[model samples]
Target chain A: AQSVSQHNHHVILSEAASLELGCNYSYGGTVNLFWYVQYPGQHLQLLLKYFSGDPLVKGIKGFEAEFIKSKFSFNLRKPSVQWSDTAEYFCALSGGGNKLTFGTGTQLKVEL
Target chain B: EAGVAQSPRYKIIEKRQSVAFWCNPISGHATLYWYQQILGQGPKLLIQFQNNGVVDDSQLPKDRFSAERLKGVDSTLKIQPAKLEDSAVYLCASSLVAGGHNEQFFGPGTRLTVL
Candidate 1:
C-alpha cells in the first residue's frame, strides 16, 4: 500500500512572502507526482506535475516545486505570494493507472 | 474540453439510508475514478474503472459502497445502509488515458452528510 504525507497542516503567510509546502510519499518504484490547488468553494486544479523530466517544475500562477527523490519530497514553492494564493494545497502520486493517492492537505492563508 | 461533472452538490441522509452520486467525465476519457474526501483529510480512491471495466477496487468497501460506469461515459457511486463514516465529499475524476502521463480532471463533488 502507498501513502502520501504533508507535514504542514496549516500555513500562514503575508503578501510578498515566500511559501513552501512539504510533501512526501512512501513509494519505491517509478512514480508520478502532482500538486493541486483548491480555491475556496472551487474544485481542485492542477498546480504542477512531475512525470519524467527535470526535478524542478513550474506551474500556473507562479508556482513551482522541486522533486528530491532522495528525500521522497516534492515541495511546492513560491517566491512572493499574494492574497489570491490563499488556498488548500494537495500533493498526489499516481502509479499503474489513473488511480492517485493524495496527502492530508495543507491549508494556506495569505494575508494582504 | 469540458471538465468532469458531478450531481447533487449536497446530500443529507440518515444512518442506514441509501444514497447515490453521479458523475460525468470528460468526453473520450478512457479512465474514471471515484474518491472519498473526509472533512480534513485528502481524497481517498475508492474505485477505478478503465473503459467500463473494473481495474482496481481494493480500497472500496464492498459491504456498502458500490460504483458502476456503464457504457464507459458517466458513472455512479452508491452506498446502501450508509454509515457515518460515509459522510464526505464524493469526488469523481477522469483522465485521458490509463497511463501515468495523463492528469485527472475533477468535478465539483457531491457533499454527503450522513447522520
Candidate 2:
C-alpha cells in the first residue's frame, strides 16, 4: 500500500535559523503532494501543495516545499524560522482520488 | 466563506459505548471527508463522500463505524461499541471538488477518548 514517511520526529531550532523537514512517499506513480501545519490548539492548515507545473512551491508564512519526483520526496523548507512557526508538520500524498495518505508528522519547536 | 465545522470539541466514552461526531462542510463544497488523527501521527482518511453519495470508505471499519452525508451538506460519523483503539481526534474536511488536486479545509476536530 501507499504510505508517507517523515524522517524527523522532533526538531528544535532557534529563531532565524534555517529549517528543512524531510518527507518521502512509497508510491511510484503520479502523485499530488502537500504540506500541512497545525499550530497548538489550531486546526490543520495547508502550507503548500504540488500538483503540476514547477516542482518548487511556495506557501503561506514563508514556507516552501520541493517536489523531487525521482526521489519520491517533497521536502519542506524555510529560509528563516520564527517563534510562531513552532507547530506540527505533516506531509501527505494523494494518488488520484480524494483519499490522502499522510506521514507520521514532525513536531518543530522554535526556541527563542 | 466559512471553513468546515465540527461539533463537540471533545468526547469521552467508556469502552463498548457509542459515540457520534457531526460535521458541516463549507458551502458549495462537493466533497466531504472524515479522518482519524491519533496522537503523534498524521490524519488517516476514514471515509470520503461526494455530495450525498459515498465515494470511498475502504479504510473504515464497517463493523463498528458508520457514516452518512445526508442532503449533501452535513455529515455524521458514528462508532458503536467503541474500543480503546478508537481514541483519537476525528477531523472533518471539505474540498471544492472530489479530485486529488483540490485543497481541503479542515475543522477544529472532535477529540474522542475511549476509556
Highest TM-score scorer: 2
Give the alpha carbon lDDT tens digit for every residue of B34-103 in model 2. 9999998899999999999999999999999999998999999999989999999999999999888999
Tens-place lDDT digits, model 1, residues A41-81: 99998999999879999999999999999999999999999
How high is the TM-score of chain A in model 1? 0.97
TM-score, per-candidate, Cα-based: 0.98, 0.98
What is the per-residue lDDT of model 1 for residues B6-96, given as tens digits with 9 covering 90 to 100? 9999999999999999999999998999999999999999998998999999999999989999899999999999998888999999988
Stretches off by above 4 angstroms in model 2 are none
Ten-residue stretch with the least lDDT total in model 2 chain A:
A93-102
Compared with the true structure, all predictions reach lDDT values of: 0.93, 0.95
Cα distance off (Å), candidate 2, residue B101: 0.4
| Candidate 2 chain B lowest-lDDT run of ten | B95-104
Candidates' chain A TM-scores: 0.97, 0.98
